[model samples]
Structure formats: structure tokens, C-alpha cells
Target: MSEPVKVREGAAGASDDKPGFDLGSGPGRLLVWLYGVFTVAAASRSVVQVILDFGRAPLAYVLSAVAAVVYAFITYSLVRGGETARKAALVCCAAELAGVLVVGTWTLVEPSAFPDATVWSDYGMGYLFIPVILPVTAMVWLRRSARR
Candidate 1:
């Protein structure tokens, strides 16, 4: 007689649901790393700008702070890696894209409006356009990961 296989109760593989959706796998790992880097860069830039001279360009400084916040949230949500977090990341990414386009255009149309450069200025020219590209990439990753 042969012994039968035994499945562990409450184990992730034993259940229909996946072992929790992790956004830090495969390609997503790169996304996560990039997001992390951006979070630090944006936050540090904004803090220094806001503290050093709030009057030079209030609008640009505030916008940079907002970008930092958005980046931090998206990075957190991605690392958290759950359905709710994924949805939050999706929403934030879309907002980030919109911010980039608006800021980029505004900087071009009215150079006087921004006395200083933001993360999204000139479509993220200061950061090699990574600010504009990161959100789009994150959105795609989030969508594909949801399906898998």
C-alpha cells in the first residue's frame, strides 16, 4: 500500500487565491526600485526647496512637494502589494501623469510662472524625464499584475 499526499490546511497554495499579489516580482521588481529612488529624490528636493526659499516660486515649490507625496504613496502602495494598494497606486500614477503634462506645458507656455524647476518641469528634464515616464510604466505594471 502507498501513502497518500497530504495538503496543509490554510496554506496559500491550497487555496484558490494566489499567495498574495506581490508587485515586487520579476519586472515589477525594477519598477519598485525605480519608484523607491524617485520617492527619495522628489522628497529631498521638495523639502529643500520649500524650506530654503518658499517665496521664490511658491507654485513650483508646492507642486514639487505634491509630486514627492504622490511618489511616496505610490512607492508605499507598490511595496504593500495588495488589491487595495494596487488600486491606490493606479490612481496615484494617473494623477502623476496629469501633473507632469500640466506642469511641463505650463513651464513652456509661461516661463515666468515658475521661478524654479520642479520634478516635472519641462516634462522632467531635470530628472532625465524619468518623472514623466515612471508613472506610465507603473500603470502598465499594475494593470498586468492585476490580471495575473
Candidate 2:
């Protein structure tokens, strides 16, 4: 008779040394997809505006570019799928939330301040508030993943 193969389980039933849940799986997958889409959307919009008429709304254009960078970094971190990446993504998500709040309030308080809208203008009202909501969701996911 052939011998039966036995599988070894590590601590907490994990078979490997990885310390956290996969950041790119389950709901994280949706977050990654959303971030990726935002990155592309914000990047393209900023690039076109900066190239065509940056003087028209320099602050708005710059902020859009900043949003794009933040989105890209979060997406990368989520896809990386490790403890370090989870921490980094958490920090970035916090920053992103702060930026959205600050810019959203600024735009509301002083409409003239931004002749055009950035990705985060009005808490991402233009983009259906996804900009504001995404960071919070990502932060929660990252934190939860850390405990796994």
C-alpha cells in the first residue's frame, strides 16, 4: 500500500510564514480595482489639464495629480499583499482621506479658489463620492487584514 501524505500546518492553521491575510483577495480585490481605475482616471485628467491649460486651474490640476499618485500607491500596496504593504497602504489611505476632506472643504468654502475641480473636489462629488469613500474602506480592510 502507498503511504498517505500528511500536510503540516503552521501556527493559526497557516501553512506559511506570511503574517497577514492576502491583501489582494476577496474585498481587497474590489478595492484594488477601484483604486486602479481612480489612478488612471485622475492621472489622465491631470495630465491633460496640465498640458492644455494648467494656468486655468493650477491648484486643481496639481491636486488631481496628487490624488492619482496616492491612488496608484495604494493600489500597488494592496496588490503587493504582505504585512509591510498593508501598513503602507493604511498610511496612504489615511492621507488620502485627509486630503479629500481638506480639499472638499476648501472647495466648498471658496469656490473661486479652484476654477476647475480636482478628483477630490467636494469630497469627490464629481466622481460620485468614491474618492472619499474608498480611503475609509481601504483603511478598514487593511486594518482587518493585519489581524489575520
Candidate 3:
């Protein structure tokens, strides 16, 4: 008889982790890598904005920090994929969608309000629309990992 395919469990019962390495499994590494990138990006942007010229556009600068916070949340949630993180990802991604849409429209119709920039400013035109893409991908990722 052929050997049965063993359903091995991971160290923490991480359902989606592949064999050989816990962290190197499937989208796990990708998620980790992306999160690290976003964390650095958002942190740096916020730091530069606040330190260099917080007075220039207080509203936009503060929103940049908030955007960074949301990105940070998304990154952490993706890396720490679990039942809770999945839900959090959904929420964060949804919020990102709202922010992008609202700010995109605002920047389009009422350009004067946004003297400074944010992740959602100009419909993410500044970031080559990556800001718009991240949340959608995050939602899909959460759904895929949800089946774990």
C-alpha cells in the first residue's frame, strides 16, 4: 500500500504553513516582506513630513500619519495571519478603500483643500497608484488565507 499523505502540524498550529520551514510557507514570506516594506515606507514618510514641515499642511500631514498607521496595521495583520488578523485585515482594507475613494474625489473636485499629500491624495497618483492597489490585494489575501 502507498504511504498516506501526512497532515503535519506546525509549531503553533499555523494551518497554512508549508513543510520544511514555518515562515517560508506560501504567501507567508511575501506577506512578511511586503509588511516590512510598508512599515518602513509609512514610517519614513510620516517622519519626514512631521519633522521637515508640519506647519505647511497640518491636516494633510496628520492624515499622512493616520495613513501610516493604517498601513502598519495592514502589514502587521498580514504577517500575523490568523482568525483575528484576517478580520482586522478586512477592516483595515475596507477603511483604506474608503479613504482612497473619498480623498481621491476630494483631490479631484476640491484640489485646494489638499495643500500637502497623503497616501490617498491624487488617487494615489504620487505613489503610482500603489496605495490604491495594496488594500485590494490585502482583501484578496485575507480571503484566501481565510480558507485555512
Candidate 4:
């Protein structure tokens, strides 16, 4: 007769050295996906705008590209899932929130300056405000993960 196999605690392919933070689980998963989507969308849009209409609205287009880069980095950090990555993401999210507020206000106050919309123009009205909301949510999630 053969004995039944038994699995040990923390031995089901799990590691005791596992990170305490997981920024890609549950709601964090959604945040990562949204950031990824924004990365692609902003990057592609900025590329085309810079290529064809750089003279028309250089500032707005450059901001779009910058937003894309930020989103990409945040997504990567969330997926990396560690204390260091979480801290990096937290800082980036704060910066992203500040950018959205500044750019949104700038667009509202100086409509003539923009002449075209960036991802964060008017508090991300063009993207249904996802650009504005994403960072705030990410910041909260990152903070929560750090506590875990």
C-alpha cells in the first residue's frame, strides 16, 4: 500500500521570503491594467501628435508623452511587487496627481495656451477623467499594500 502525499506549510510552492506587498492583486490588478492601457494610449497619441502637429501644440503633446512615460513606470512598479517598487509607485502617483491638477488648472485658466488637449487637460475630461482618478486610486492602493 502507498502512503498519501502531504504538503508542508509554506511549501506549496510558496516562499517564506515572499514580499509583503502585492500591488497586482484584486483592486491593484485593475489599477495596473488601467495604467497599462493609459500608457499605450497616451504614448501612441503623443507620438502621432508630435510627429504631425508639433508646431500646433508642442506643450500639450509633450505633456501627453510625459504622462505616458509616468504611467508606464507606475505599471511596471506595481507588477514588480515589492517594498521598493511600492514606494516608487507611491511617489510617482503623488507626482501624477500634482501634474493632473496643475495641467487641468492651466488648461482652464489659459485656454489659449493649450490650444489642444493633453491627457490631463480639464482634469482628464477627454479620457473621462481616468487620468486624474487613476493616480489617486493607485496611491491609496500602494499605501494599503505597504501596510500588509
Best by lDDT: 2
Query: lDDT of model 1 at residue 61?
Result: 84
**Which candidate comes out best when scored by TM-score?**
2
TM-score of each predicted structure versus truth:
0.87, 0.90, 0.78, 0.88
Clashes of each: 0, 0, 0, 0
Per-residue accuracy of model 3 over 1-148 as CA lDDT, tens digit each: 9999887556575654332332224665675576567667767887898899988887777777788888788777666556666777789889987888898888889878878887679878988887788777767767766565
Score candidate 4 by TM-score against the native. Answer: 0.88
User: Considering only N, C-alpha and C atoms within 3 Å, which residue pairs clash in candidate 3?
Assistant: none
Candidate 2 structure quality by residue, lDDT tens digits, 5-44 = 8876454666343645679899999999999999999999
lDDT of each residue in 1-148, candidate 1, tens digit only: 9999998755754544332558878887888888888878888988898899998998998898899899889888887787778888999999999999999999999999999999999999999999889999999989998786
> Following a full C-alpha superposition, what root-mean-square deviation does model 4 have from the true structure?
3.5
Candidate 1 global CA lDDT score: 0.87
Colliding pairs, model 1:
none
> Candidate 4 lDDT, tens digit per residue, 26-92?
9999998999999999999999999999999999999999999999999999998877788889999
Scored against the true structure, residue 127 in model 2 reaches a CA lDDT of: 99
| Alpha-carbon RMSD, each predicted model | 3.1, 2.8, 4.3, 3.5
